[model samples]
Every structure is written in C-alpha cells, then in structure tokens.
Target: DKKGKYTVLSEKLTSEPMGIGFKKGDKELEESVQKALDDMQKDGTLSKLSIKWFGTDEYKK
Candidate 1:
C-alpha cells in the first residue's frame, strides 16, 4: 500500500500525528493554516502533495 522504498514488515504499532506548532493562543495563525489546509483538500492539492512527499496517500486510512 506504499510507494516508498521501505517495507511495512508489520502492522503499524503506533500513531504519530504531525503538524505545525504555534504560540499557545495564536488564533490568527491557526485560522490561516486551517484555511490553507482546507483549500488544498478541496482542490486535490493535498493528495498530490501527500503523494509527492510521502509516496502514498493511503495513509488517509
């Protein structure tokens, strides 16, 4: 289910979410980032970027 060079070998043992960090109360920054992410998902840019960077979008599972 992956296009990367590595093998899965076994089922995923843990979950690790990734994202940007900001100051404790940066609502403006949060809003802007959330908007960009939404726009990308809406336009299919997120899928393309995910494939390019992670080699597969099956991680969406």
Candidate 2:
C-alpha cells in the first residue's frame, strides 16, 4: 500500500500481536466480539467489509 493514501505502519505496537482492545476484566465482551468476528469470517462478511473499505481483502496478503 505504498501507493495508497495512507502509510501502512508495519511495526507492531507491542510484543503482543495487534487486536481489539477491551477494558480490564472484560472477558465476556472480548469473547462476544471474537465470536462475531469468527462468524463474519465464516460468512464472508468480513472479507466483504474489507473490500468495501480497503478495495481488497488485506488478509489475503
């Protein structure tokens, strides 16, 4: 995406891989969000949303 409008930040922000952040002890909310993401991935909604926003499925990279 060097030619794209925004510069992609290749560096990891932390030792932990990037992911959704939750409030302390928000296990239930985190699990719910994970399940939603999993469902979207299975249903192609996630890829569709990616394409809609980024013009491609970034995950394919």
Candidate 3:
C-alpha cells in the first residue's frame, strides 16, 4: 500500500514533509491552525494539494 511518487522514484530521491515550528505561548494560533487543517481536509483541499504534488491522492487516508 506504500506506493506513490516517492516509491516510484529511486530510493535516493524522495521528498519530505515540512515541519511547523512555533514559539511558546502560541496556543491560540495553534488551535486555529488545527482547525484550518481540519477544514481543509473536510473540503478536500489537502487531497488536492497532495495529488497536485505527488500525482496521486495519497493523503486521503
């Protein structure tokens, strides 16, 4: 099941996800971000982005 653009590419070549780093005392911002991510998933925007970048909708899981 682990198949996608990265799998199709050579082992030496692969992309990585970006990590979000926030300073302390940003709970409100973090909550808003979490809500935004949830909304994006609900609206299929995340899946669209994944497909646009990876050639397949691998983020639906």
Clashes of each: 0, 0, 0
Give the TM-scores of the predictions, in the order they appear.
Answer: 0.65, 0.64, 0.64
Residue 11 shift from truth in candidate 2, angstroms:
17
Q: What are the runs in model 3 whose C-alpha is more than 4 Å off?
A: 1-17
Cα lDDT tens digits, model 3, 1-61, are: 6566454542335566666777788998888888998899999998999777767776667
Question: What range of 10 consecutive residues in model 2 has the weakest lDDT sum?
Answer: 9-18
Best of the candidates, TM-score: 1
Each model's lDDT: 0.77, 0.76, 0.76
Off by over 4 Å in 1: 1-15, 58-61
- The lDDT ranking, best first, is 1, 3, 2
lDDT of 1 by residue, 1-61 (tens): 6579786544545568777998989999999999999888888888888777666673363
- Pairs in clash, predicted candidate 2: none
lDDT of 1 at 55: 64
Give the Å error, residue 53, model 1.
1.4
